[model samples]
Target: MPRFTVFMGLLAMTDDFVILVVDDNANNRFALRVLLSRLPETEVIEAAAGEEALMHTVTRDIHLILLDIQMPGMDGFETARHLLMTERTRNIPIIFLTAVFKAKEFIERGFAIGAVDYLTKPLEDNLLLSRVRFYQVLHARENRLADVVRQLRRQERSLSIALSQAEAANRTKSIFLANMSHELRTPLNAIIGFSEVVARSATIGPEDRKNLEIIYRSGNHLLALINEILDFSKIEAGRVEVVDEATDLGLLLDEVIKLLLPRAEQAGLTLLAQVETIPAVVRVDATKLRQVLLNLLGNAIKFTRQGSVVLEVRGDPATEGAVRIEFAVRDTGIGIALADQRRIFEPFTQIVTHAIGAGTGLGLAITQRYLSMMGAELTVESTLGEGSVFRFTLVAQLATEAVEVPASKGAVIGLAEADRGKRILIVDDDPDARRLLVQILAPLGFALAEAVDGMDAIARTASFCPQLILMDWRMPELDGLAAMQQIRAEQGEKAPPILMCTANVLGEQRSEAIAAGSSGFLVKPVRRDELFAALEEQLGLCFQRESTEQQKAAAVVISPTDLVAEIATLSDEIRDALRKAAEELNTSEVGALLARVADDHPHLARHIAAMLEEFQFEELIALLHA
Candidate 1:
């Protein structure tokens, strides 16, 4: 009895443990309550009828129930049946009490209705207390169990959130790694490839010119890749501030197409555009918009094989004469599967099966992010082995007049013409680089002097008294920074404008250059246009040709008809050789044989050469047939 009383106290100590007593008569309910009331902190809810008992069980934690067999409306058996049917009260152990000892069948009926046990009305106090104590212990266990379940649920939720955050972190890290690989590999490719070309070239031969050309193209590609990567990182970090201005979307698209035409033609893919009659000018971040469009078009060209890559611009006439610009790039290439579609947009995620070469895989990812920044959604439709079409829309205000928007910083800058025949100094440790710079600048009407190192550059600055100095930023002895400082200290403000020519695109590199008395920075493997732009900026030098870059671009677009004409006039032996070359996919043989076909087919030769380079043998054979 002492142990039973202690158990009862333990149950009451739980405080939330509850028991229900139901009887039609007050005396019966009072007797049940009196027994339960002995337990400290235990709650006993009394009901004179089955309905009141059900209400108490529903609203409270009724762990145990004591019922009267005969109630006024719903009898104890019916009540027990109802309790088993309800979730809250179903698990509560019920004991039925009767005025008389029930027959076997009557007792069996009580058990069938989910009554835990039966007790006569003239009950033994000890027996009743023992049964109550047993169920009380069970009720306390269930309460503790429920509390544990709730705690586990909370932990599960916390774990779910942590896992999600970790997954997102992994994705970000993957992007950073992929970009770093690209940034490092692209330049390395050029440096190594060019170094090989130069190292192998002891004497000028037939291959020497081709080697030099390869080196030039590789370096240019490396420079472009580095600049793009730097731009992507800066913009992703929100470091590159955006300037919104009027932009000609049509013109921008045209520039992108022109830029990629060489690549497209090389792949033997037709590049086409469709511009619906609508306003083309709009106000946006011109540089970012251009970058986005360029990236998408570039990806389309990169992935596509033979069919046409089309850029379509269809704008709706919006309110107040504004425009909703829609841009789409469609290509015939290896399309994405449903399972990999979303994964491909994630940075560094590439479909390895469709991969033609090494890539950073950041193109579409960067495009998607740029769209999001501009509050646009990127949509894609693709089928395996078919093609893909990527699209986005922007709400743009129509430009009322022409606006001259300067390109983003670190890009080529142009200036008005200043005094010609200005003495300029070129400095670099490498003889090839100095020769290259001389070859680039000597033809520009500038009196040029060369320096092999920083010390030489400083000496030349004093002796030559140059108007501008193009110094290498990363020389071996007395680097550009120190040399510039020394020159500035000697010549004071009258010192020539020192422009750094280096591959470094870091922000601090430019900052340090300026702090050390440098005028501006020019990225390495400097194209002729970029060199002119830098000179114009510092020396006010206007280029001779107004459409210089355009001229260069026009050289890239060869007439297909001219190529057909050239193929038509080929001799029988040369034609057979060309066909054999096409079948074997030998670009060199095809070019060499075509060189003698027609003297006026220079551009067509280049086109065929490009196709041959890209291994578009099918197209090449077709062209020879034409």
Candidate 2:
């Protein structure tokens, strides 16, 4: 019996495949099973009649059915008719087992009922196995095709759902942006308007004047946060571009450091930059790369209160064709928890939310998107209390050949003395932003003027006869782009260097502005140095490099006594540090240092406990004297 079973299994393996044997004869069923078992993959299922075969075909995954022409109740012809009419089992291949011989009419009748092939009374075993194997292969292919069709249908449904969800999310985001614009601009207008009125007032006391300065600075910082959000949105939508060009990486790094150094200092934290190596020349999108570096360094300095925020660079040999540089910002501040590390990079996700106050929280998200576009990746390694290190590699196209040294020097061209009395028109709907620009330029001896809207700006231009017009995008009645176009139309080629002073720093917006007759762009809360530099460049000023010390000294210098008075006026963390330092010393140099510290790390508060241990009475007093 065991040997017989082994022989049957071997025969089954040789020609085994699924075959439905349907007949009223028990002998016929047994014979068909034995015959099919001789072939490989042959799994013969028995059905006593046509009705039983049709039922089995519907219930199980039978590939082929051989039906007897004459059964007791439901004959082969009627079963085939039923199977063909039903959708589920219509595609099952069928073969007819008949005693009838040579009538074309009977053959045509079987073909009409979906019989693919037929056989006579005495079955040929070789012919039977051969036909069964042929149908088996065809059936397997159909099964696979059916599965593929099902998968495609499922994928189509999934994509439809996803697309709908994305559209809804986009609508919500659009509404959120509109609401935020109004909420932010309203307070910003008052802060800017009141500060301007006080700053320019000749009758205001020095103390009152100092108070106004604080209001102006805070407002400006808040404005920067709002603008960052707008730019980030544009970037995520793929509307931002890298504008690839030869960039001065060192100068870019220095500027970013200069902007954030004051904040780091205010927190009693050192800001350290280490350039172990830098590519002498590499092609990059200077503006976008600056945004990336600024966001990374800014976050590092904001989080690191006591320890230094270190920026380190290294060369990557793999990216030899285009110089690959590795940049990392390491900080020992309140490091992100392991669980929150991934979330930290997401938009609007601030780890120490209360500590790092008043940001739109889009900086890191923008940086990530920017890096991705450049075919790079950013990763962070952190421990909850230890610190975090954010590192990314950038491949900037290397200059094919060496360029002139003068071009590489990043020299800042000073405006000729003629700029002093030149009339300027500032067109911005944001009153605070306009005020900031006026204050920065007015000191440089320009006859500054402003317009609240684009229409007013065009009207002001005719009489003002401004040498330069700093236009803001996203204004009511006429936006910066439309206004610039109108201005260019009226003035033709003589549209005096219309520069766009906008928070919409997205590349498309920049190109649109330039196409509309803007000579260049300056991103906002316009840095004083960049603002002047844009003016000089647009006004065709000759280039001149200033000594670093002279540049630092020339910046609006606030004395320690004056700064302490300013610090004494505030209610923030930095202000509290100054008050503590003031009680310890007779003078307010501690207040000045606090003021300086506030300039750098406005979000940080000095640990009074640490201060007690670090300073002696005279040592602390000397800081006040400085």
Candidate 3:
């Protein structure tokens, strides 16, 4: 009997296919081996008994097995049962070949015992070859498929390892950025804070006041740059969120123009603002909007050497209560090339031809992202060697309530009599930072204590029992979070309100500090007013502000005649040096020159100082010549 009849074309065989021949007589085994050898790359193993066949199946990688129905000790049927019982040789295909057991019941039993085919004593060679070839090709295909599966598993493992490494590297980069921001902002806290403190002194002459103003403004500019970098980092981390509030668009625009006017004047460029019409108050993210305008106007001033930079704003009614405001910043400078226009919006990208001044190249990129977050797109128009206009429109609902002009929190002279004796503990590792807090609070008549680090602050908290604590985030002895946790655990609800004043400006860092029981979070270079507001909130204290009359008296300007007379009193050499310093716009040199005049002619120096404070350089120069 034969199972496979149709003969396809002769197929090529691989060397991997191995066949086992099991029989009672050696002659039958030899005949099967000869027939299997006809196939290319096929290996045949001869087993005289079923026992030998089982041993071969275990030791060798057998693909196909030929079994005899009866043997002396272990027959083919019993051997097949044993093979099926073991896990190792269960999948090997078996064929039953028998001479005596050719009866119908015996054949049926052979087929039922897991034999792939039951052949009679007189075997057909062609049919046997076709069947053997079929199994050989099938086994070869299985082996190839198995090889592919193994290769795929190896590739998957490699990708998993690579992905893990990439994630680890990104984490490292984020940590490095956090540390860098903290380190940079810590010292800036003192720089900006101390400048403001000194500038507020009533006794300081107008010349000294002007110099301090420069220091304060420059510190703020540097702080803004630091913030820009941090903002980009936040954008990359997908943590930036827009915080909308009622904003006086007109007032904000005025303030931005005033801030950047000095730069434009220095560059001999005109800065103009044209507002056709706009809502008095609109709901929007004031901080981001201000930043966008600053970046655009600043870049315009930097690039244009002689021409004017214009900030034109137009508004139109959109929906029932919303206004679509189109703000455009146009400059007369070297414009961006058509090829580089789109590239300019990419982070840290600078056009070669338009790189006229110092910048991080992040201004426009940040501006674009900020606009995108506000549901707007920043578009640009430019002509090479002419100028460029960057414009964007935002739709904001009109805030119906009148924008309240907050009364100036004029120079905080001192705390009210009730809060004068309240105890305050300042905790920081940096001496300057502690000194800054002392400078701000000690003058207000608060009983202040200073601690070097978190551990020292915890000790002071018990001994001094301060009413309020200003804690720094990073310290040598113990980190702020861990130390704050310990204090909260020990003191529980009795703990004094602890404000975490740190240089870590990240939103997540602030969240962590608050989660650890911080009363409030303050990012540094903390403004004096901001620090005072935070204290007032925590301590429920009122501050004594400078009176209206005192503020007015401090702001009074010197008469032109008095200024001219003061300039005349200076020595010929001093007058020339003063004129030269004012002409060069060297603020420090002018301040030094004014000190010389203050020594002998105090009244005249004060008058000339007023002129310097107002940036009346041309007037001062003419008075010097007179």
Candidate 4:
């Protein structure tokens, strides 16, 4: 059909349409064909008799037909009669060619049988083509409309089918969610219940108690996974909310560090905290803030097996208004693949690696959503086998409308030990962890006492009259929050700084623990430095750092003459700068940190380039003289 339209369109321009010559006499047909050939782009088909002309009308494809009206078994009238009777050829325009008949009767008869006009013999070529082109345009337009109608019908059917398939897929997803929710929640409730029971029971034997600690840890881990999944669903559904309150930003970070250090240590990694110079308090949904930090840092620690995870704060310190503080956690673990970097932030997508364990894969997905809600964004920079730095920024409203204040010398790490002779109670369900924690705290000038559970802790609290109480939250007879509530009812305003310890150190949990009478909270496997800092800050005890003279008295001092030894322990910036100079290696096109390195450590200024190149001792000794 399209090809026929193209042919007609070509004919329309060239004045070529269909011209049929019909006659019983062969001479007449030949003469007619020769004359009509003068018309450009016209097609002439010859019929020797009326019968042949009728066949052309009924079967051949053409726009118009010319009929001869004399001398045959079927005359022009009979053929025209047949054309009109049949639906296939009825609409075709017919012009009668009659040389012998000028008879009015014959003309009228032709008109009665559906002939449009009669042309006598020796037809003019121009007159014949002009009539053919007229009908050709009419027929072409009809064919174009028919094609458009067919296309619209096909599109209508396809759209209906697609809509039906989409509806079916939605129904399947709904059903799956309903069934899986039950399967997940039932097992989670049991794990949390039994783990709490064992952790609270004082009668658990030492060997069995270790096993119980593992069980409780695993259960808490399970609970964390479930909570993450639920939170992700809410986020995907656009239902997560951030409830704001005036919060102590410094205290919040203290809890986050304590929670993450154990995981960092288990993987043999280092975790360090560097506080920003800004207002210590901020208005935020403390719960959401914590969740965002934990997710970013947890993923950093999970992927990083070595090196250090440093949490540094960056922000605008000039104004007490909405602050642009960033929490960046960096680690040197298995770095994310370049291709999977963007995909890792999407739900249910994990980097395809055998070493990285499986997850519900919503950590970063939820983290990004939470940060975005708080007018913040998360950014990452990483290289394959090199580690990643995940940082996010938030507008933290100041706790009070005041300009920045320098931390008091007492507020910042200077104080005297008034509780030097006081006893301290440490309650935890895990003995190794308890013993390890005691080892770190016992030497800080306190008589340390122990308790295996909350019941034991409460009993020891009364007898020991301890100045400090470090409590573990997930334990037996009572959980830490419940135990603290009971103890607070008795102690009233005298309640010491009761700290709660847990592994899942998300923001929501911390706020709940703090609201339930916890003066502070720490994450498990706490680092010694952080532990002491927490003890001194929360308990108001003094942590002694040896002075230069004190170190000399203890024989732990280094001589000032040892220039090489002194520079080796300096910053890597100085070391690299020194090494590059000694090796004569060109550094990056950007300016080096030479000036800053000199300002920070003046004694190592001359040796910066040598240290950067890792120059050998003898080479450095020789370079010093040269």
Candidate 5:
């Protein structure tokens, strides 16, 4: 509601009181004025009729109204009712003066019309003076009360305006922080992505490779700091979101350890993790839980210079598959002082230690905040000389399905690489991000197309018809959400899978991309393997970067007898359908046939898809005969 100002008209007076005397007869008005003047410090306002009396109330301050009962146009009773109706004149006491109406009924009627007192024609001058004085005293009290009320309302309106401005400023700050997150993360993604690609180059010399590794690590650390700021802002604003799904907790721990192992080794710290003997699969927010563990483990490893950093997970199972799991990280480096434990959790609070890595102090604070949202807390125990231990517990329900954790990719023996020239689109406003994506995918023998922003992505998508798209979430003209919606609406079935990449890993953004029909959402800086994994999953591309074109050509060649012998392990019924589909050149049906055992036999799926795309029906003889 908008603020409102109300001007109230109540009887106001100084030491000298002003009275309104209304009468049609000039003689009666004179008599009432002369009689009212008997009261000390008094001034009489004369009105010939009720309308004139109302005008006097509006123009001048009238303490009390002395209305004559016998009037030509508006009588005294009617005039008293009018005086009681208006806010300006309502609070003024009315005294009716008349020679008649002394009967019980007329006297009651006079008081019923809001008259404070009534007097007959032969009124005593002394009594009239005392009544007017009593009314003036009562009017003074009402004015004082109304003054206080008006003051309170003014203060209330001021507070309301200030509160509105504060809320608006907070909203503006939130928008700035959100935009700042996007602006910083866009280029940070490119830096981390490109540095990692260079670090993994086999052709680089030892010294150069070492420098590249340093660059890669530094970029990653920078990305982490940026993430910490964004996360802290979200948490502070109460916008943190948690998404729960079925995940293998054991594998999650292993991946975190794998990620930190290199850094731990570089620092000469022994890093190890152990998952207790319990059910591996559980329903939880795997992303948040992994983040918590990563922070704790990374901190433990970073702070431990010469000694070991160990991560341990233990599950205390209960009835109905409910388990209380405790995750702890222990280190043997320089321990924190007891007084500093609390301060270290505050943002930007750096511990004085001999460790090399300098981290944004938000890691522990964010971890604790995340845990608190999940109904948990972080507990720490540290001595002055020895290392420290940090732990937390979470409740989870065990998953019924057996978890099939993927083993390491291992050596690519006999892994036939897919045909080259698979077109992939990279969409971002930042040129560095686009160039970095090209660097990551070009060596894998894929054709690359670039779009500057969301608007550019929409314009080029239909014609380029890329098999995959890595779209940045924040863009200038059109954001990822709007562009994705438009592309899906226009292209429908032909729109290629879009994997949105953003620096923000908030669940709301993830949910938005999913709602907009995005195929995947990846937070930057994206890892090289994870990026390829998404491509392989979405496009069914077999990644064997070392496989030459000469080898792929030789593998698809066919001979009638040799082909039948090659797939002798195949069943008869599936064999007939494969040959029929290959003959009719139904690529989708061929893909469906290949899907039957693709999970178990990715090599055969890649082989069959390749032959089907090449239209080499002779090669299908072996697939059919299998």
Candidate 6:
């Protein structure tokens, strides 16, 4: 009973234990049932014959069986044989009872039939009850083990489902970010590109040019915000990798300063660069370094309202041609509280009381992650209401002479004489986008043609026979990748070098463009210099340059006040059409409408045409509204 105690508790909590008694003699069955009744939570089913025993085993959850030999029809050996032959009742323990004295023969035959024990004539009640109790304990353990296995299987299924759902959610987030980036950059391309074109105009007055600069800077600021979010996503997905290359530390630092100089000026904060000692060139991930520096300096400028923000660098030559460079961004403004210093590096965390401007709060987190990937740690020191310094150190190899940074090139005025008149095709769905490229390349003395979509571009490619093709990635009817594949299949090596110029800024999109036979990739909001650079690389074209005086003399100055007056004199119908076209930023339609006004006033048409060439839709819209 002591050995049975543990199992009895387990069996009481579960299903009842069933015992089947198979004996032709009713009295024998009754005797076995009375003996089995002593066991707790046990039920006994009586069977008068072997057939009845088989039925009871199929219908009941039998744990053990008692069979009597020397019965009327089926003997105990035959009943045991029948029970052992079936799959369901095979594991049920059987004890045989017989009224024979042939111990040697009867016991051997009964044991051979899978009986647990053989009892003679008059069975001992205590011995029978003990065997039943032992079987009951074994049955209870088997049931508990099966339940545990079932529960484990259920948990495994739940975990698998959760993992699948998480994977799906991640995929959805990635797609959403990519699409949002493209949608944002599409219009920003026009905003930044047109502003840049206007800012470079020598005809615009100094004050007008300054306002244009503000617009240009603001457009770039929005673009940077978009990039910050996308970059954080890339880091979280583990898609970011450090690509080391020859980088000019001085030039890189200069570029960052130039980019942030206007913001510092607008904020009335003094920005300084203190370089103690640095190499001419170092091997590192220039893009990541630029991003980290930009984040640090940008934050410094943002938090500092009245004081100065300084970027200090010190480089010392280290072992194996490596230079240990330490960078520090120090700002005199409202400093971080001691309690919130560590939390600043965490994603989307901001000290509301100390913050001075709006931000995604991921800048420092991303900066720290980028530094960690480059095998460096970012540290901060700050005093409340005083100032703060964020610093990091990295060891980079000195670049060889072969890795020298090329000097910045001057502005490209036109193509070289030899490369002039080369056929160039521009494809885009947006009319303003196509006009922007036309305005840039057409004036460069190249033969430029426009296509509204990928299919149109393919048709023009064969008819116009362009030597270079600038194709947008997304479009209706067909996409850039599919169109490029078709052209490559049709023309083979005869296909022109296709530059994928689109708003898609994702890394995979760039890879896809190259794999689809694109000669190069250029993101939207492309600068005049970047477009020229891409053109030069692909077509091997040398661009003609003009000095400041020469460009100024060639420029035409148009006064917006006079343009609005000239528009007022035009017919109401023509004026309305012009305003609508300007609102839509449809440069082609506006050009056509302006042609109607050319006959009336050549001077007014010329000025308006100049604005259209510069993609000054905003100015035109304002003038038309006035």
Candidate 5 per-residue lDDT, tens place, 566-615, comes to: 34545666667777887787777777887885775555565555444334
Residues 1-626, model 3: lDDT tens digits:
23232221112233668888888788887888888788998888888887888877766678899888878999888999999999988888988887774368768887787778777777899989998899988988998999999999999899899978867876776788789888889888888899988886789996588788877877887887788887887787677899988999999999899888755654445688999789899999999999999999998876664467999999996578899999999998778889999798998887764325445678899999999999999999999879999999999988877778777667788877877889999999999999988988888899999999878988999899999999999999797777788888889889899999999888889999998899999998887778889998999998999988888886644434444555666678998998899789787898888787677877566555655654656545655666
Q: Note the Cα lDDT for every prediction shown.
A: 0.73, 0.71, 0.82, 0.67, 0.76, 0.82
What is the total number of backbone clashes in candidate 6? 0
Error at 410, model 3, angstroms = 6.1
Each candidate's number of clashing pairs is 2, 17, 0, 25, 1, 0
Model 1, 311-330: lDDT tens digits are 98898876785778888989
Ranking by lDDT: 3, 6, 5, 1, 2, 4
Q: Across residues 1-626, which tens digit of lDDT does each residue of candidate 6 receive?
A: 68578555434532789888878878888878888888889888898988788776665668888777777776777777887888987888887777777776988887887888777768888887887788889889988999999999999899899979977887887889878987999899988888887777779995587567667867887898888899999899777899999888898999999888755644445777999789988899999999999999988877764568999999986668999999999998679999999799988887854324567789999999999999899999999878899999998988885555675555687877888899889988988899888877887899999988879988998999989899998899888888888888889999999999998887888998998889999898877777888888988888987776776676454443454566789989998998899788787888798778888877777666655643545446655666
TM-scores of all candidate predictions against the true structure: 0.58, 0.59, 0.66, 0.39, 0.59, 0.66
* Candidate 5: Cα lDDT at 307: 60
Tens digit per residue, CA lDDT, model 4, 146-168: 67878887887888788688667
Off by over 4 Å in 1: 1-211, 224-238, 277-280, 318-323, 352-355, 397-401, 405-421, 429-431, 443-445, 451-459, 476-478, 482-492, 511-517, 543-606, 617-626
At residue 9, give the lDDT of candidate 4. Answer: 52
At residue 488, give the lDDT of candidate 2.
83
Most lDDT-accurate candidate: 3
Q: Residue 585 CA error for candidate 3 (Å)? A: 11
Q: Which ten-residue region of model 6 has the weakest summed lDDT?
A: 555-564
lDDT score of residue 292 within candidate 2: 85
Q: Rate residue 444 of model 1 by lDDT.
A: 54
Give the local distance difference test score of model 2: 0.71
